[model samples]
Target: MKHSLIFITISTFLATIILTHQTSSIKCFDHPNPLNFHQKIPVNCEFATRSLKTKRKSSNDKFQIKFTCGMDDKKLCDKVQKGFESAGQIITSTISIEIPITIDASFYDFCKTDNQCSIDNNVVAGGANPARTIALMDEDGVERYYPQALVKQLPFEHHPNFGPFDILAKFNSEADYWFEGDDSQIKPEQADFQLVVLHELVHGLGFYSSWNDFFDFVNPKGLTPIPSVEGEVKENMEMIFNGFIENIFDKYLVILSSGEHASNITTIINTIVNEKGKFYETPKDFIVKFKSSPQYLQSQIMLQTATTPFALGFLPKNANSPSEAIVLETTLNPYQTGSSLGHVDYKTYVNTSDFLMTYKQDSGLTLGDFMSIGGNYTGGPIGPRLRQVLKTLG
Candidate 1:
């Protein structure tokens, strides 16, 4: 009787435990639980350091940009805003599109001294919140300084840091040294400065990387607050080269006939030079002038790459100019004429806009008709296509 009672009690206790376990809820592996379900559940919660796709919310809300400057900062910041607005207007006009962000300008009157000017973070534009917006600074909330040594520390010495918001631009207030005579179209001294800003705006539009990886490596030491005399000289030299070949229509004479066409081409060239900086324009001109540079020739071809300069290598010589020489070699027919070699030469600048429109509108026309007069495309169709896009964008 005693044994039967003991056994019955034990069985009852075991049954109760089993029933409770069966009715309980499932728990994630990380959650604390009294039950042994943690081992049974398969949950993978690995953190990703870098994501391939950048996430953006479609709120239909607009962002406002305000410019802040010091008392004696000169008109550098104001002038920059004007140039940026010009580019923005062109983009809006050409595409009939408006960016989600709107621009506003104000000159800050905080930091003015004999040496350097300072900025007060306390007084921000109404729409701008230092806390809400990305600080664009280190953990201590201190702005990063651009000096010669700082920039040198970067992977690419003194290269620009293209950020979306609250970027600090340090440049000279004078434009006289940067521009000579009537060469004010591109304003060589400010080319890189403009390019960096443009690049940052592209970032704001989600054209580049989603995070830190989107940045091009530049030395922080080089960005420190130091006056750069050599930098100004370099910028001025670059403008001369960029201004030349961008209007190849002038000397070629074969294609350039109208004043309107010349004016438009000149404007487009100046725009590109301003955006890319004068450094890139020199090598670009070398290719077009000689009619043998692949990289230069490729710029005229329309191509697209969100991250890299793919179409730059397509041209034979320059980035935007069309080919100048076409070589033809033929073997003589024995019956018609004694064994002899025949050749013909043709030199002219081809208009990419005309070709791209034709290709988009008509398909039967061979690629040879648009690329070159003859149908000899040993290289793939990339160079031709990229030039088309470049022309359209311009």
Candidate 2:
């Protein structure tokens, strides 16, 4: 009774660009291959769990963290574990989660071998994702994938196939990190390990997008669609996608120019699918027809909207107007897969209060430094906008 699940890992990177020039350019994009959704093989729910030796609960009893250190040094392992605990405590105190969430945290050298690390220039601080996801119906009567961590908070019946842990978090043990408890102690050249942990944990709680360019080769220029998971088999031996489906997070996304929801599959299909009620059966079939049809032009337009500055936004739940929408990271010219749609615009939020979710993080500056410049520092790295988003998602 194994079900195929799609997992997305959002990695935090220390940008190579200097702090002074961060607004103009930030090279924090993940390596293309690992970032591509199509390149990753689907994981089975049964085998997703990991065995960790140490376990600790947040002070508020809202989160239980199971941790393991792959690094050889015991002192370094203890520091990283403490960092994870500190991050979990921050999150537990901020949000009210009735069910205690369990996180599996691993501290390891991501680039120990030659091909282990993806990015050549920048150091990947860490990455995190939900251990599993369940396909459930949303308020609009549309079925969408919800992260296991979030699902536990909802009223839905507990999904039987879900793994023991809600979130799977991993950090780069080799990267230069400030492992001290105080944010003020973080050096300019070193990334704040606790801050990075907080950032990664949020991603695991479903701060990501499934609206990607997975089917780009079919219509290269303007191909950004939530690819149909039509062939995926579920644990009950049932097929998942009858048509295009989106993750729950995608429901909040809107095209700023047109004021249309990104999850409006009917409008998208009408625009790009040439024939009515005749969807392509497979990727190969879609490629043949798409290349020979005029529908690709529409796809190019879609891509344009995604890449254009201030074109895409996330409208909070029950918002008054589009003007209140939170701008997403769409300024990246050639749409860098992982860093583009899932993050806040780097240029817009670089030094602002919403800097936590931005695509690039500048090394050498502590969380306190960002709060000082941004003016309002309530607590942890979870900025105001990000906190609003997490609350809305739940």
Best by TM-score: 2
Residue-by-residue lDDT tens digits, candidate 2, 32-132: 22222232223433322222212334447678898988878998898898888888887887777866788888887777842456354466666777766
TM-score for each candidate, following the candidate numbering: 0.23, 0.78
The true-versus-predicted C-alpha distance at residue 162 of model 2, in Å, is 1.6
| lDDT of model 1, residue 25 | 20
TM-score of 1: 0.23
- Flag regions of model 2 displaced more than 4 Å: 1-59, 113-120, 157-160, 182-185, 216-220, 231-241, 265-267, 270-282, 291-298
- As for candidate 2, its clashing pairs are 188-364, 222-299, 222-300
The Cα local distance difference test for each model comes to: 0.23, 0.63
